[model samples]
Target: MHRDIVYASPTAGGEQRDLRLDLQIPRTKGPKPLVVYITGGGFMTANKAGNLDERTYVAEQGYAVASIEYRTTTTGSTYKDGVADVKSAIRYLRAHSAELGIDTAKVAVWGQSAGGYLAAMAGATSGTDRFEQGDNLDQSSDVQAVVDQFGVHDLAKVADDFDPETKATYMAPGSFINAYVFGPNSARTVVTDHAANRAANPATYLNRSSAPVALLHGDNDHIISPSQSLILLDALTRKRVEGTRYVVKGADHGDLPFLPDPEAGRKWTTQKVMGTITRFLDRELRS
Candidate 1:
């Protein structure tokens, strides 16, 4: 049976914002890896109940899936708040690892788009306790591996090269991310605020301690450019960090609906993405 778990106030200001998780457990007594799945909405609209259909499919694959809801730009303009919420979710799950039947040692964090960024962050910062406050050491929120699909890894770099002539038009109202992160200056400051931009970026924290990551992105994505993934892969390689990156031939950003179509290039690329993720996870978790 599926369970919906609530984690109350993992952090200081999270008292009013309890995290909701959709836990899907397979009907087996044997131990299985716990996959923490994060949904993508450009850091704006998705929640813990991400695409229920997909959750069911993933559960049928013989793994328990925990779909997480994190604080979005809608809750705050800064990126730290969202990052804080994800870290809190991990801690909450780890704290209840026994009750939830979570194989904490084999945890895999996976997500798409903004959620992908969070997954990568969770894996990379597994050993760091930046989100912990006071003296709570009972929880172990480390991630063994990461699966990032069209996730945004670099914000400062993206902003620096954002189309100068049409930056305003691109981030206008109704554009989910624009509406969520910047209400008034959604168009202007996304390109203007240097300090704010840096603080909201994920690439700023990369180091040798980061966990292994598998990246899947579309080469033709206009929103979060493929260049972002390329840069991230390059950095990971430079640091001698284990990582895998694949660029879909023609798929757009977050367009899973267009996958594996015989007429489209995504058909071939989708197969590669699946193999890469499976192999990466097997090596990271079962090794």
Candidate 2:
């Protein structure tokens, strides 16, 4: 089913900033699992329509996909707001589970770069209880698994060790992370604030209860660095959580060549990683 896109309700402030959501389902008669896909644009550039092709590919594999639009990292929207939007989108999906024709419990999340980080946050953290401004704390919007591609794990960790060259490349207004997580309020020192950054970084929340994770990073990534994945992998190990990490050789951040060979990249991304995610969801959600 190639369904049209829909928008959820606005935030608490009455901004018309609705979350864009789309559904893609295969032609199969029986129901299938759902995958909520978030895009990577440092929280500013991409939208639900922007990544329809990839969503279609996943849907063709007999899974339903929900693509969401979060507040941009540059449009004065705080990082917390973006996270809230994703959580709300999942709530919307669960609320409409019958109409969407998919198992609400079987949903997983997948994203690249900044979006990946958000996906991880969605997986690790529970839905809003108080910290989030517009969160519906009562909603059960948690995800079952996560696929993080070159996403940041520890914002404070990366901020402290950002190479000078990387800093120059990300010459926004404040520090790269400041601009990323805080937007123009980069000077707010949220990166160093244990309460703030701790809530934002997925690494800080990993524990025995965390969903299984699949982390893919390019060994040559200059953006978030391959070490980002290593950090999360280490955390997962420390917590005794099931997880997998794949370091693609020679690939830069978001570049295809840096992945294993093209064929392997396709297989690893769509088949191997997807399979692992599907199996994990089966175990966690279906079991």
Candidate 3:
């Protein structure tokens, strides 16, 4: 269902890693739309195989889907490096579109939790320079749409509110975002680096030409406050860009359905989420 490839040369660590992605192709002959799905681990630890069941479901819907890999901050990779790796992944995939049986031009980047931030970055910075890294520079790394599930929109805001006194920190030293901004090991001062976080936030990059984005967030997401989505919604509205969010009521971080019982008809189901996503993708990518 997938293959591995070294998309880049040796990193600053002098180790050339074999970054891999799972590519699932439908039986259709012609090139199909691509969904590059990213997994979330708060930027600390996670991989391409994190969300297998969901991605396979998308692939079954007549598309060439990919679950991509990116270096995490826990491995000494910076926030910029992670985004660059994602951009490079997109570029590498597009470069080999013919081989992968994918429609290079109709790609969507999708992710959950922290990966949601990466997916948003992929869509927001499409034509922008600076984030692109590694090989396959000729192919465009832009994605048509972004499907983010509970990713933070403003890092600085979160860091600012994350225990201003340092005693009540929302993010511990082991958190990947802290590693991203302050290296793998962090000082108390690193949590309050407002300026740095502001500079790298996705909200700072939004514009009229930014690709359409759809966010699915639990209203009661304890890990990432729903306020993050509100901030993004406000920014997107102000920018006059096409963006929307689905707030799953009474839902927490790991719960897909808002209700306590799956049999309850009052909450969202896996099929409901997929239907929303597939319909949005079709409206944005299909004719």
- Give the runs in model 2 whose Cα sits over 4 Å from its true position: 1-4, 12-14, 127-138, 159-162, 168-173, 190-195, 255-287
lDDT for each residue of candidate 3 in 222-252, tens digit (9 for 90 to 100): 6677777778878888878789988887766
Candidate 3: list runs displaced more than 4 Å. Answer: 9-14, 159-167, 171-175, 188-191, 255-269
Say which candidate scores most in lDDT. 3
Q: TM-scores of all models?
A: 0.81, 0.81, 0.88
lDDT of 1 at 52: 61
**Residue pairs with backbone atoms closer than 3 Å in model 3 (clashes):** none
Better of 1 and 2 by lDDT: 2
lDDT of 1: 0.66
Task: Give per-residue CA lDDT, model 1, range 155-200, as digits (tens).
Answer: 5444333576444554444354444445433453544666655545
Which candidate, 1 or 3, has the higher lDDT?
Answer: 3
Query: How large is the C-alpha RMSD of every model relative to the true structure?
Result: 4.3, 4.1, 3.8
The local distance difference test score of model 2 is: 0.68
